[model samples]
Target: MTMSLPQQAPSPQHCLIGPLPQLFHGELAAYGAALAVADTSAPVGTALEAFLDGPQLAAALALFALRFPGAHPKALASTWSKLYFNALLVPVLAASSACGWCFPLAPGRVRFLADTDGAPLRFVLEDAGAAHPALDSAARLQPLVRNHLTLVVDALATQYRLAPRLLWNNAAVIAEETLLQCQLLMGAQPRIAADLHFLCATAQWPDQLANPLHQPTRLVANVRQRQLCCLRYRLRLDFCADCPLDCRQRQAAQRKLA
Candidate 1:
């Protein structure tokens, strides 16, 4: 079962991708407060941080469980990154583009709220999804998603201020990895991957992008204890099917058998 938008009815304000800090500030704030663990703390940072932890990552996984209902918990846990790509990242990109806004998401500017079960319910944007197109609305949408990815990563690294090379390496790696999920959710469009490569190229990412459709090279292996991603690690869940650990194991096992 694919994770298509729900068909109950589309309320402009009641969208999976709703205008935040405006349309549903109450709901956003309530959920954000849980992350901040206090109202006065920074909600945005706390919310993004949730994507990394097990309890918080559940918010991402729940989206898949809802769509592909009846899947075992372990099964859901295996592809947690897909949940982040489809539910958290893509919706923000799509919703913002539909309204013709940048909605430049930094951790502090957005809040992802979840149900009591940790399923992502909606995104609360820092600005209205109002459109003021600088270019043709149709042509500009893809760039919005690409640009948002670049901007948010910088912001996350800055917020953490951890000089470890791992953060940068992982972000570059995951950018390509997550784009695949985005393409799957978009029904396997080739352009999504193309635009993603364009963005990585335009940003001059340290990892030289060889092919937009292939794995991007990380300039340095800062992956100390790297699992290619930490999404499932929090749950002690199985490695993602394409995770580096699993990849190496498969290669080694193949060579040994030969």
Candidate 2:
């Protein structure tokens, strides 16, 4: 008699932001290398522009906008601008990071919302909910908004093991700051902006440090199958060089020994 073995379930696959990251990393590296070789007196704006226009960064921003449909394009663009200024420009100009390779810094706000059917929807509370009557259009969109927000928070938690409090704090701070800035510059009222700001501000990164959901780490989907499932991302600072030399060098030595 022949015995049969039980079949195992197929594991779901994930796709990380691939080509974009590679492109950005390569471009930035090249620019940095060129700067290193050139006279220190060379203009800095050229290198800065190169980094900003790098294929990877542009692709990443586009991907981000597509991934979170609930976010407004203008708002997304603004967030990217802030991120570039804060994470890249600030660090590089300040000469903070080791290779001067500033990681992409995304402000902590900018989220997503989905309809009841799981389709993505854009939601922004401009002027404390007064300027945009659409935000309060109906109660029907609440669940979608909540679910989208939850998915994004959960995803981040899974990826970074970020503390809930820290995530919430960061989100609130960034959202409020961004919204307030928008209100002033665009003459936006308080209600919608404030409300929207509050929602994003209060959103906490889901607690997934203990048990994470089974999802692809690099969440890749075909063009047709892609759903705006992710919302908000922070540029991961690659501080390997700036990191304390003790542990890093020790680990290197250990690897050589092994």
Q: Best-fitting candidate, measured by TM-score?
A: 1
lDDT for residue 193 in candidate 2, whole number 0-100: 52
Query: Please, what is the whole-model Cα lDDT of each candidate in the order they appear?
Result: 0.41, 0.29
Clashes of each: 1, 21
Show model 1 residue runs off by greater than 4 Å: 1-13, 16-86, 94-101, 104-109, 112-114, 117-121, 131-194, 201-234, 246-258
Clashing residue pairs in candidate 1, if any?
A: 20-125
Model 1 poorest ten-residue lDDT run: 30-39
Per-residue CA lDDT of model 2 for 51-98, tens digit only, reads: 233453344456656545655443344333333222222112112111
lDDT of 1 by residue, 1-258 (tens): 113222233343433333322322332332211211112344433455355433555444565466456554543443332333344534343333333344435554556665444444455555434455454423444443434333434433344342223333344444544454556555554455454555444443324432221233443356423334433432433454334555676456446434
Model 1 global lDDT (CA atoms, 0 to 1): 0.41
Give the worst 10-residue stretch by lDDT in candidate 2: 1-10
